[model samples]
Target: MTHPPTTAIRHSPDLEGELRAASKVTLIGMVLDAVLGIIKVIGGVFFHSQALLVDGIHSFSDVASDLVVLGVMRVSRQKPDQNHPYGHQRIETIGTMVLGSILIAVGAALAWDNILRLIQGGADQVPGWPVLVAAAASVIGKEWIYRYTRRVGQAIRSDLIIANAWHSRTDAFSSVIVLVSTLGAMGGFIWIDTLAAVVIAGIIIHIGWKFTWDAVKELVDTGLSPEDTEMLKAIARDTEGVRNVHELRSRRMGHDILLDIHLVVRPEISVSEGHQIGMQVVSGMRDALDNIRDINFHIDAENDEEHPPTSEQLPSREGIRNLLDEHLGGLPSHTRIRLHYLRNKIHVELFFESPDDAPGLDAEQITRHLQGYPWFGSLRLWFGAR
Candidate 1:
């Protein structure tokens, strides 16, 4: 199970910078898609090229998706509040899902149109050099936007932007189909134009499915890869007082990671020392991974897996103290006692101050006396100097 980090994790400037970069790139893409889409639709109608017209519709869809990206990026940058402790990173994931669904719907409609056209035979008009020119321009424009948007997306770790980049790249490929089919139609093979539209539809559906499938996986809290989990485990294991590390888990929040782990330390240490070890783990992980927003550390005295709980039939502290006094004359009133229950037995530790001249039973005698009790696990006798 996951727990909150020891410290409140805020969205750092790096994430803000990434969002800024993505927004700017997407805005530029929207402008290019609008202009290119208008050009393709007008030219397609004038030259009677159905393939080019469908490609134009695809470009328009990119414009719509870019608008979604711009809107989501704004809300996703909001700070965490009482209502949403994890901030708004999942907004981007949801935006990606919406974008993918839109792409699929648009592609399905285009495919259905083309399929009906193909079944009814081919259009009579031949596409001229004008249609080919528009397709070529679209390929160049959309591909440039694809590369630029993808670079920005990677820099900011924005999945929505990256998905949109692939959407742009799909447009570029679809334009290539439009260009090829336009050339074939000009050569008197008119049916090829409709067939190319069908091909473009298939490509759109494939890319759309990929984006949707990935977003769904993130929504379900899919963990990091095994290799990444091992890397985090290694970081915790290398901490100063951590003897071992286990139960390490991770989940993604935009570009950042939320982690949960258990740090094993020697059982004899104090609570403060265990906390210090946990701090070491937090610092080590923060230094190792820039995008780690939170880590929950659970300190273990020993491997709980190796030593399960036993039946609780042991005597209470007062009962044990009475047994000690009854067996060994008496314990000093100022004595400090600690009890450790382990492996189905009780280990006793007692501390008291004794002057050099004072007389009392030695450590060996105390151990010998406590050994008679079947429930006794071990004994520690400490007499401090006066």
Candidate 2:
């Protein structure tokens, strides 16, 4: 037996609030990026700091990425529809990938420019005091924004928001590089500023690659970490009626998890009983893991994972009843026949009103008659109410 999907765990009001919070943070970052980008570009030009100029462009890239995050977050929070029954969360993953690619391209271009300049002989002039002030201001502003964004991301469990926060933090780091290199240049080592630009480029590329690769892993349906998978298995095993848990599988859809597992139970239990056991497992998993969105549990009479499924060629209930009728000679009226298909054979139980209803109907006689069949397992007869 299989249970239907569970959806009661998700609350729309809470989700809406989270999305609103994420948007507010992104907008704030966007405004900050734009202001800082303009300042660094102007300061780099007037103060003759190439490193500061490249950092300025990096700040503008953050502004563009902020736009991407805001747009994606809006779409990603939409409820599941007929066209997207799993919701639009993967839109956020795709957006994160795009953001990472943008960082890569920007970092590579800036690095190449600095490398070419270094090869042609470094700048002749030192950056002025104003460049240091601009870089310092950016360091403080970007660090503050990074922390604010990260706090919101963790609260909402949003990967895209967290990725954006790291992007902001990178800007702060690049500004720090600018501050150091500008000071070095002022001390007459003009090559330090250009070298610092190359280092900043490397940092941007590294961060971008990390985000992009993580997104790719999600897109490819990577399972949860080993620790999480084991925890889920432990929860299922602890359920009341589950004899064992096998073939448990899990994957993520945005911040939520989806799971399916095969649960072994006593072979003779009623279908409804097995389904109840599955429900308990689902409840346990949800209580333990808040992010679970859906769970599908297959109730099994035995561990079918290590063996082939009960053979389809075996006689079905109808076929078995016909054989019983033919060999046992018209079983008593209102007879109840129960069939257990296990280990490639059938175990039969027949309940009837009374023994006198079928005179001379001995178990040995029936077994002798049916023993010739390849699929016969065993037989038991009940002459009274079952």
Candidate 3:
């Protein structure tokens, strides 16, 4: 009934702006990649170097991938409507997978072609100092492009941009091999060009496989690193209004994070008080990370201890409701509350105005004053409570 995702905090305006800028940067790279690809393709066709031609094809694929990123970004920005509830964040990840898959395919093709040529004992020789110079210039340019793109992607936490940046890096490395092969062909060693081509293929294949692995894992709903999960869980547990946390799942969508956490509070907690606590947890999580955008905290009451003594007191519904009223006394009457039982766990839900409103704070100094009460299991938060 509930699932928590590998979620991150909402991004700041600067972060959002940064991501948008990243998309723009991708378009720029796409243009550059396209131009370079065309040039290399023509040069390779005339000079007859399979390595340069393959590199050109790789660049062409990058242009296509950049287009995918642009499309995904545009769609992802559209506000969620009736057709989609969780927002369109995953579309960005889809872009990354598309790009990664393309890279891998290009790499495999290059590798296959080289293997075939080597087996046939035949390879073309493209002679001239101009080709080598051009390749060296391309290598330098591409490497710089890689660094620029990579820095922006990391700063903005954009997986698509990061993937695209690495694509440039592969291109740069591939060009280096191209340079070597060009020089080797002129040095009277024909096999050197073939060997360099093979190396270039190997490099491309490695980049493709690595990029694909990251993209595919996210597409499949894999959790975040164990360390990050533990840290997030700890933050939720220690935050006010969350008695216990469960069903905590975290998953990545490109550079973004989505989270769903079940929060536990005392069963007697009022709608206002539980909502307050949920808000606190959300704030805590938001404060903990810079990338989190949404928090879905499901507030519920903690169940009573197992094997309760016959003489021990059990909270009455009226008493629980009274406690909730006392905690959330200032809230408007329109607030709604829900009750649920899961695996014998008792929980009470309270709809509050906003998590930021601390109604009972006129009486307490600490953040978590009543999370230990027995009437609730957890408290979770969601924006625009209905």
Candidate 4:
């Protein structure tokens, strides 16, 4: 038997608040990136600092990425619809990948331009002191934005936002490189500025690759870590009435985890008891892991993982009742009948209101006759109040 999954499409209570937080931070970063991008680019051209020029382009890339983050946050927070029952969380993953791609392209183009200039003889003149001031301002501003964005991302448990936060940090790091290279140029080594631009490009490409790969893993439905999977299994096994746990699977949907497991219980337990055990397991898992969004569980009379499933041709309840009637010369009226299908056979239990109802039913004779059937396992009879 399988417990139906809980209503899986409902939105979290704090989704609106999370969206607002994400949007507010992203907009703030965008404004900063635009202002810095303009300042560093114009300053690089007038002051003759190639490193500053590249850092300016990197800031513009941040502006574009911030825009992507804003759009994705809005779409990813949307409620699950009829066509997409799992909600739009994967949209955030796609958006992150796109942002990474943008970084890669921008970094590669800038790096290639600087390398060409270096090959053909570096910059004609040393950069002016104003480039130092622009780079310094970028370092301070980008660092502040990085800290702010990271705080919001952690609060919301958003991977996309955190990845964007690191993107901002990278900008700050690149600006630091610009400052060092500008100093070296002013001290009579102009080659350092062009070389620093190459180094900054490499940093951007490395971060871009990490973000892209992480998103790809999520999109492909990667399972949780081995430690986490084992912890979940331990919780299921600890629940009372559970004989064993198997087939525990998990995947991520944005910041939430989706899980399903198979639970084994005593073969004779009532269906209600089995269902209750499944519920307990679900509750236990949720208590231990806050990110679990949904769990689907299957209740088993026997461990299907260790034993072959009962054949489809095995008699169902109606068929078994009919067979019993034919072989027993009409079964006595019973208050309830329970059937346990396990290990490729059926065990039957019948409860009668009183002994008189069964008349002279011979247990040995009935057993002898039913044992001839391929699916027969065992039988038990109960009389009096059941």
Candidate 5:
């Protein structure tokens, strides 16, 4: 007998709560980013500060990314459809990629513009007190947002929320750079402001690249970390009645994981018993790993490497029943028969009801009666009836 794979089901309450939390935080981030961007742009133009102007560009990028997060979260929260049986989680990953790539482009553009100004020696002009004030206010505001978003994100374990919080924190760092450079330029170190733009651009580029690489890896169906895989395997092997675990595999879809593995059990167990053991393994693993969304468990009666199914030549259930009727007619009808196909033959087990006594034919006598059949390997009689 061949056992098929089992697929695990995901509960929706956690997912729904995550979506709600992410939406609320991202929306708040969008408002804060928009306000900060407008303030910095106006102040930079008024005070002639190159660093503050580019810092505004960074804040604007945050606004755009927050919008991307919002759009992706909406789609990703949708239930699984006919076209996408795995649900819409991957869309969130693609959204992250889009945001990252856009940030890279924006960073490159800002860097190039500022580098040209420095090469032409046109960025030597000093900024006024208003530019420094705007940068200071931005630093405070962005830091506050970052801390709040990070707290909520970690509580819910939402990648999107956490990523956006990092984005905000990066903006705060850029504002700090702007503040320092503005002060240096006012003190007659005129090139410091232009250099600040380049540094801010580098930070933006690095953050963008990290987000893009992580999303790309997920899109390629990368497995869980080796440590997590080891933990999951240990859980499976510890399951009662599970002799061993093999061929463990895992993949991610957003925050959830999908697993595929084989559980080995005693060769003599009935099919129903094997199924129960597989279920137990699944339950234990689910309790250990909260992110597991589904599992495809394949039950194996023996080490498949040692005993291939195609090599087995065994009597069918009907053939075994007919043999018993023809040769052992006095056996009670209520007796249960179990056949274990192993070593290219059938190992038979007869189970009797409570208070039932042993049959007249012993194991050796039954084996002798079926001696002419090449498919009969061994026989056992179990008389303790329960």
Candidate 6:
């Protein structure tokens, strides 16, 4: 785990630029939702249209939900630090939870209002065509918004935006239903509009619950689906020097994935060599699934006792960092220092592959011995080995 720094790597400038563009699209979505919600509500009321009101209420919540998504996106862009070593990407998931809750609240509130209207015989009013036309306009506009957001979300692999994109489309869906009811009510059947409102309320409730439960699952660190797990396995197997990929664990933290795996290499290979192989494996995986931001790949010797000696093959400390990076979820070793005072003290910070199936030898005992070197001073260490 305690290794030195390696060479530098660069990010794709085009990709970075595209991601920034995505943020702007999300902001536009938030503004549109708010404006559309207000227009529908005012128009619906003026025309005595239940369907229009239902659509308006549904769109209204979209504004709040999009605002939540934008907030999450803002937090997620922050760089990783001590407090959030894994970065703030998962904050997007928390945002999703809040958005879901808001949806449910608004949907339930509208449903309650509909119930009140039914109880008070509010369905007796005949809905007007003007309001129905407004609902149709809203439906078309929101559907366009959904299309734009969805394209951006998919290209960037943003789950929050994707979910919100569908949410907007749901508003459109409700508006379409409202349009139908308003047209039906022109035939002197007022209950048609009332029934449509009730149905629209049901749809909103269902969508809200879906988002709520999904976000809750992510917050709890739910495992990746079977499909993705298999895909990762295939990725590891195809990598050079990886004998097998085992203990492949995956968890969804918001839109990002935290994955860990054990890559078995030839036993007797130096720890540094094994780590190099692990890094290669991780690189392959990233290419396979661009959505993955964190990956922990533990390198293990295959048939250690039967393999040849690896002591002479190990690379120097300078090269160890690159070799061991895969174990730290692709993060390079932080810092390695040698303090020469009355005694030799090696202060190194590092991360190791800590998985249940591939637990390495004791880490604490090695730190104590390493600190006993001739230049040992104050020992600062973050020890992890696999």
Q: Which candidate leads in TM-score?
A: 4
Q: What are the per-residue Cα lDDT tens digits for candidate 2 across 1-386?
A: 12233223332336688889999999999999999999999999998988789889989989988988998999998878999877888998898888788778777886898789778976677789999999999999999999999999989878899889988988897898788778877787756766877888898899889889889988888888999889989988999988898778887777778787888888777777887888888888888888888787887776777777778799987898889889878776588887777778888888878887768988888999889999999998888776
Better of 1 and 5 by TM-score: 5
Measured on C-alpha atoms, candidate 2 has an lDDT of 0.84
Q: Look at candidate 5 and give me any clashing residue pairs.
A: 8-294, 8-295
Q: Tell me the TM-score of model 6.
A: 0.67
lDDT (C-alpha) at residue 160 in model 2: 91
Candidate 4 error regions (>4 Å): 1-13, 114-121, 332-334
| Number of clashing residue pairs, candidate 6 | 8
Name the better of 4 and 5 by lDDT.
Answer: 4
| Model 6 CA lDDT for position 268 | 36
- Residue 334 C-alpha lDDT in model 1: 78
Model 6 residue runs over 4 Å out of place are 1-19, 110-122, 238-240, 302-386
Per-model TM-score versus the true fold: 0.80, 0.86, 0.70, 0.90, 0.83, 0.67
- Model 5, range 182-275, lDDT digits (tens) per residue? 8877787656756777788788788878887888988999999999899888988988988888679899887678888888877766667877
A best-first ranking of the candidates according to their TM-score comes to 4, 2, 5, 1, 3, 6
Q: Write the per-residue lDDT of candidate 6 for residues 1-386, one digit (tens) a residue.
A: 22212321212223345447667887787777778778888887888876676677777667767667776777765666799877665777766666666657766766777677656754557776677678878888889998998898777666677778878877887777677666666776545555666677677677778877988887777898899899889988888877876568788765667787766666435557766777787787788777676777666544233443234333445543443343333342344322211112223444334333224433464355444443323333344452
C-alpha lDDT (0 to 100) for residue 121 of candidate 2: 73
lDDT (0 to 1) per candidate: 0.79, 0.84, 0.68, 0.82, 0.79, 0.65
What range of 10 consecutive residues in model 6 has the weakest lDDT sum? Answer: 337-346
lDDT measured at residue 106 in model 3 versus the true structure, 0 to 100: 69
